[model samples]
Target: MKRTDIYPMPEFFERYINLTDDVELKDAFAISLQELKQLPLDKWEAIGDKVYAPDKWTIKDILQHMIDTERILTYRALCIARGENARLPAFDEESYARHTDASNRTLEDLIDELSLVRASSLAMFNSFTEEMLQRSGLSFRGSYSVLALGFIVTGHQRWHLNIIKERYEVLG
Candidate 1:
């Protein structure tokens, strides 16, 4: 399904969704994955847990955040597609980042986890029917369709990667 297929885009995630192409969900996933795999790991490693500014996340933190956020969003999509009316709880990124052992993990390992998560996400999204894709559920921010969630996953990665490029890349 294409971005255009999403009805009433979630306002809170507009910046992320806008960062993505007007392509099919599967295509968007492919492009995002490719971009992720091409990231300059050597440079990032050289930075070595440095944050560009105070209170900002390290490169590893950011990568872990991306994985965590995607998992939460994908789960919401699944619940919504299955006709669940219960409102999903919002996740605390700061808490997750602070508490996780992402610091000890190698960049390669984090990337591998991310790739596996994306693959799982793609499989889930592919299983949804047209009707399921259109299904909406209330979220922490607002209502979102399954298709929108899929695109948001791609765009959210794009958003963070852009931040890493624009901010973190300049540090080293």
Candidate 2:
């Protein structure tokens, strides 16, 4: 589906929406998965706990945040596809990162968990029919379709990956 198909674009999600190219959802998902799998784990480990700026997310925190956001977006897509009308709540990434103990975990472990979470998301999104993918629901940012959420999930990852490359200087 086209990006314009995602009506009533939420102001906050504009960056993510703009990051996405016009493409089929399945193709978008596949491209995102391949990009994610290509991220160099050794580079991420080498970065260690370094943050580009004070109070910014570290490499581990960023990875955890991506995993968390993907799960939430996937769940939202599932709910909307199933015709649920309840407005989904928003999550605080900083609070989540503060509470998460990624320091104790290895980069390999985080990558493994992220891969599993992404696989589950892919399966869930793949199960939806075209009509279901077009279904809309309320979220913190007003109305969003399942297909739009899928794009958002993909774009969100791309945004962070760009940050990893530019800010963290970690190239895959």
Best candidate (score: TM-score) = 1
RMSD of 2: 2.0
lDDT of 2 by residue, 1-172 (tens): 6676776676777788778878877777778778877887777777888888889888888889999999989989998999898898888888888999888888778878887887788888889998998888888868878888988998898899889989997422
Tell me the TM-score of each prediction against the true structure: 0.97, 0.91
Lowest summed-lDDT stretch of 10 residues in model 1? Answer: 27-36
Error of 1 at 12 (Å): 0.5
Error of 1 at 147 (Å): 0.9
lDDT of 1 by residue, 1-172 (tens): 8998788989988888998999988888888878878989999999889898999999999999999999999999999999999998998888998898889999999999999999889889889999999999998888889999999999999999999999998998
Top lDDT hit: 1
Candidate 1 wrongly placed segments (more than 4 Å): none
> Model 1, residue 141: what's the lDDT?
85
Number of clashing residue pairs, candidate 1: 0
